[model samples]
Target: MSPRQYEDDDAESLPDSRFLLPQLRDADTEDVEKYQRGGLHPVHLGDIYDGRYRVVHKLGAGGFSTVWLARDDTEHRWVALKIVVADYSTSVSTKSQLSCHAASRCASDAVFGFVLERRHFTLDGPNGRYLCLVLPVLGPSASDLSKGIYSRITPSLSRRASYQATRSLADLHAQGLCHGDVTTANILFGLLNIDRYTESDVYRLFGAPETAPLETESGETPGPEAPKYIVKSLNFLSSIESVISQDVRLIDFHQSFLISLPPEQMLGTPAEFLAPEVAVGLKASPASDVWALRCSIFRVRSGEGPFSGFEVTSPVDLLRIVIQTLGEMPSSWGDTLFDYYGQPTKEPTKGSPLEPVVETGRVRLEDRVWKEDKKKPYPPCLSDTIRKPTATKINNSYIDGYSYETDELLEALPKISENEAALLYDLLSKIFVYDAQKRPSAREVLSHPWFHMGEL
Candidate 1:
């Protein structure tokens, strides 16, 4: 069965143990009951894998696998050991082959380093056989770094990071491969010479693993299949400054596929980054990847995504936001109609003012005319009026769509200069088009002036 189908099948076969298992207070840890057969293999600190790798700390976990920071005794280096759940263990060879192909294609260049699978092995456990892939240790993801007070990085740094990320996608596309899922979470910062640090140094730098004991509501000790304690993922790297300066590594190719052979269904992509075409049940392509890349760039520069704030229960909800934000969908989509009024009259064509327009003079709050018809939310164009009192007037002619909470949410983003913001807006507009064919290629995105405006 395909991975997509396998997910459905697994869900159907697995018993719902919500009432059986004890409620875990730490939301960061993985589900404790997922320690049975065909689920997560129980792994703990100091556990030896394949007689070579020694698990030291937990990196993170996902729906299908768990990543651990391990020390390779034979190679004497730090490596990320990604252990795939037994249910999907059969596909490890295919995943490994794809990684090798990508690595070989970009072997000559070190700038756009594709994720390479260093080595892989199989292990027997109470949960069943597990496929373990060893890879180079990477730092925090772009999404993790771009949060809290450090939401927005320096413009130069943002430019440099965006250029490298687009270049990596260009290389992959040139090789006829598409990173089906291209979100900020998949782009990680590369740690320089990570193996040089001793185990003690690693603990001191990233802090020791934070763990809590697992328990059963029935007051019985958990079986051997379950881990004794749950280890919290070390989401952020301690060296913030160093992390921002390092180059980026595009990781996670599980959803990736060759352009010649597209999957029937695309799985694992974040709802906010799903492209219009893909969200409408169309097959993923290089063009779709470019669309997702544009969204990722927007989020990297600003704290939040373009289509955020709405509770996205499914891809259709996200598609609605896309139509609401970017205007109506193309006729080619066929019957995917959504009612939206007061859309911007001017499309994001060349020389158009797509960025938020702010007026020159300030208007006092009391003197300003508030729309008495409170039933209809104010248009996005007028959002700046409330945020910046000085910039009072907004040309409603350019307004797009009825009131959007996303605009207000965007107002809370870390401030960037007017010039830089305009440049970035222009770049996003060029790629955020509804037609996939009209969107710029990954290579063309590299040549965009936004990436060249700053020192990067």
Candidate 2:
């Protein structure tokens, strides 16, 4: 058998297969087919980039980029190297310009931690030129930390993290920048002195890198454009207390844009956090950011967003869920529906006026007197008619096929304290409106009583 083909009995004595192409079962790894043109750039475990940063292990991968844990030989420190796919390499200049401003602002204020680009370079590959960014090594995302049976942090930690996240947004909004995509996954915990960790320490903390060979469907060897094997991303293992105490840094600016000059295309924000206005063909602004912030706050406190349980296959589905949870869409947004669908002429039924139902009265037990005889002792049968409470109609006539009731959507929300729920409802009510212009700014959100319920 070839050296690349290993027998089951000889697995233990085989040499390092990092560079050898070996076929194996599929594991949780990035799509190997993405190594083609305009996709992910193929990289190996020990490959050196720009003659300085040496790739140590994989960090993670997204649709547009792959992040690696590398040691900067020049500085003798560990750093995260994000290699952007050739398709998105054009945005490097825009990101670089924004990073400069962000870095300067962060230097002035040490309290807020924003992941600013330390340095960046270009590398020519088989697919195309790729952009590589050097950044500080950090801990796991808030979403990962808050995931489990409980699905949330302590109330105090949630409050602090929420406040810090709002402050981060306020800072960005103050600079005329809108983080187009704001979600729990982008909120990362800051780590201290991670650069001081040696290779042995890294192995001890994160364990050895797990990898699986890359093989084509036809059982042929993959081209040079693809790596021999795929490396599984490492998960940051740390104590809950440590994660709770650490500061949060807002990372991933690929979707971010200036509020004054919004992007022509729709942002790539997750479906769950997509603002109502944005979902209905509107540009992202600071108000949209506020909408996403409220959703993120909800996720931090509860395990998921209020609308997470509902399936959102399309933008219209998301709009339906939003309307089901938070009343009807504003009349002004009616025209946008036509624009979203590209053609429309059917007239929707006019929504009725919202009116509160009042209860007449409750029957008192004392009001009914019962008499019993000496031989036949039995309570009198009450024949009063039992009335069912009138269900409140949610005026969602804006969407043609919207059939969900208000109570149905509200019932799926994550459970929390009555007080917290009330505060959150008040906050969401103000921000979840269809009119993005009416939403409060992130700075204004910091002053809300929900942020300062009792203590920090």
Candidate 3:
């Protein structure tokens, strides 16, 4: 809920979404010529090389560090390595930023680093805590998938999206790890070809009287072989192929703590995704994981970022959104709406990031916020300043802004949460006694709430 730990005097050094993730660029090296390289320039962070994860090319740079999709030549696998290097020489704020990344990585690697340590290495960087940890390379994040481009097959594929995501979450539960970041781009799908069956089966899954434009030439309802079913399912957010790829595994232990703590007291998640307890600094448990997942599923359903409006970017406001909307976090689905957006969260604050940057015809949401008053109505795309934010950008900035979007971004994660998502958050409380010593083991979290809901 609070901004990352920083000295009060060293404020004003934090970065926002627009500034955090530099454009994704392929590392221009001779080793990867065969593979397609996305056009982007590498930005350096930290002291550079981390043993096996040599700084090949930078994918994107952020406040804590730069994320580079590098080849683990020694280990023989593609990896997304984060290097936290800030110029503390001149800027005390830069040093603080580097320290924050180190603490977070320490917290994360303390638990999950070993999951791949034998397969990888953890060497020291220039700074004491500043180190490089490696995890498998991921395709574009859920935000990219939302913008469309996670798959090549299945012209349309959505039924598989939920199933894939649920199954992935179930997999995470099997392990003690929970994927805190569960947005669309993070939910990468494997290859899925629904048309391997006959064409008739296709219509059975997706003959919507609602959207698809049936061609005049085709007389009968499209069959299983058709991609229409997949396309119909996307609903502008994702396609079936993309959904199937959304299976989640434990990654990014930065925010995740070892499986301990009371259910309601879980802390350290982003504002949008933070369980009710996280803001107050309580222990997190399986039930808290469920709460995070429920919000994520809703994000998948709606293509847009969770609660796009309202500038309440702080953690306090985000938890207010959760408490205000769906009552207390539940162990099961809220009223069984596949996912529940719940209720009206607080409106954006005047100090929020959506402050206007430019103008078109009428005033936009940015306009209202920019001038520090009610934004005048304006057509979409008022200007760069008034434009809507990208999910990952908002997700990244929510923490910097301490805005409600933290939880909103959490809700929109495309990956799956670690333990089984519950109808209520208290289920974790019952399983993990309030007394920290009696809290359930990370292993227990998986079976306690496993319902095989991915079939949905």
Candidate 4:
């Protein structure tokens, strides 16, 4: 049976737990001042907005916005209502972010592209106004699913999800855009049974005043009051059959940026998922997104990132792992000193507006390559080194004698077929190239043989 059918038949028997939305924490002094400046107002179940959307429950919250599962009386369906905290919308950067989001909506209709589109409307509050974005209610995020499902995701499922994600990224890249943050949390499943009520009932209660009354089998308008649908603890992901047919969608464009413009901020997730170029103070590009995408694919399949489980968990260690696993950084690029925030600088001076310069431990070019006898041996130039890599004089210092083998990082990877494993490794290496210029574009990666492994 369809998920919606099950929801319709069982909704009445389910306990009314819609009010279980966790109470919003009290706003801090700064947030209070922002709200006083017309930022946002408290929302609760049953609260009406713009005389149309009725709040049903909270969906989730982020650093700058809160999403609620709201019923759009005009459309007579469920929609996700995202409200940017009032104060943030006032910032110039936030305006640019919203513009990027608006552009993403245009690409959502493209074949294979899956950006969460926003509806038109700016909701006004008494103290602080808000930029209201109405979107389709989607299921759990990829991160949530990954945690629950763990390593059970099959190769076919991985290929399909990755294929869709690549197409989405390629679409963005074609438009000179970059999803600055492409973590699993921003990817969600497109599931059913999100809303419990039938459209007929919704029309009867909130349909247009001038429209004809909603017709029933008995040819009569229902009572003015209808029982509200309750929000229950949904195990939707668990309920979904282990099939490779399902698709994923990309959401959250607040961090998206245009590649043609100068980057305004350092973006992307922490150590494990960050791109090599991003780690070494370079502007984000489509290739950076590719890097994150590769990391995400690995995490979804293996349950952890390449550099996640090390005893020494620091940015320096991450860099070390990258060098060991991916080979030496380009000679010229390797020696370049970046400010703490990964921005290139002439000199590594302390307190020099650099966030925290990457610690380029004393790397010797000779050490980067493995001997001919070693597994995964380096090229013939293994003996070509003259000087130690100059370390940035920042708070964090790199270890002089530190070294690693590529197998150290690959050991935790899941065991697959020899051909499948080789294809996967080759694809990852291409995207994770030390030089961003050499990294394959989303379209190029999409055309790789790994994705066409029969199941596709």
Who wins the lDDT comparison? 1
Against the correct fold, how does model 1 do in TM-score? 0.77
- Per candidate, the number of residue pairs that clash is 3, 0, 56, 9
TM-score of 3: 0.42
Highest TM-score against the true fold, candidate: 1
9-35: candidate 4 lDDT, tens digit per residue: 778776442122222222111122222
Arranged by lDDT with the best first, the candidates are: 1, 2, 4, 3
Tens-place lDDT digits, model 3, residues 1-456: 122333332356642212111121221121111111121112232223455554433344333344554555575554567544323212323322332343344444333221232232333332323345464544333343332111121112322343445444444444444444443434543323332423233233323212222221324543322212111111212122231333333334343433432334334355565555443344565545555554444444334334333333444455445444445444332222111122222233211221122322321232321211112222222121111222134434422222354556545534334343342243334432223344443334334333333442
lDDT of 1 by residue, 42-160 (tens): 89999999999999988888878899999999989889999988988877568567756865776377335567678888989998999899988887677765532223444566677
Runs in model 4 with CA error above 4 Å?
Answer: 1-41, 90-112, 124-127, 148-151, 193-235, 238-245, 310-317, 333-415
lDDT of 1 at 287: 92
Candidate no. 4 TM-score: 0.63
- Model 2: worst 10 consecutive residues (lDDT sum): 382-391
Pairs in steric clash, model 2: none
The weakest ten consecutive residues by lDDT in model 3 span 27-36
Q: CA lDDT of each candidate?
A: 0.69, 0.68, 0.35, 0.56
Off by over 4 Å in 3: 1-54, 61-63, 73-77, 84-118, 123-129, 147-162, 171-250, 261-266, 280-282, 327-456
User: How does model 3 fare in lDDT?
Assistant: 0.35
All candidates: CA RMSD in angstroms?
12.2, 17.8, 18.9, 18.9
- All candidates' TM-scores? 0.77, 0.75, 0.42, 0.63
- Quote the positional error of residue 77 for candidate 3 in Å: 5.3
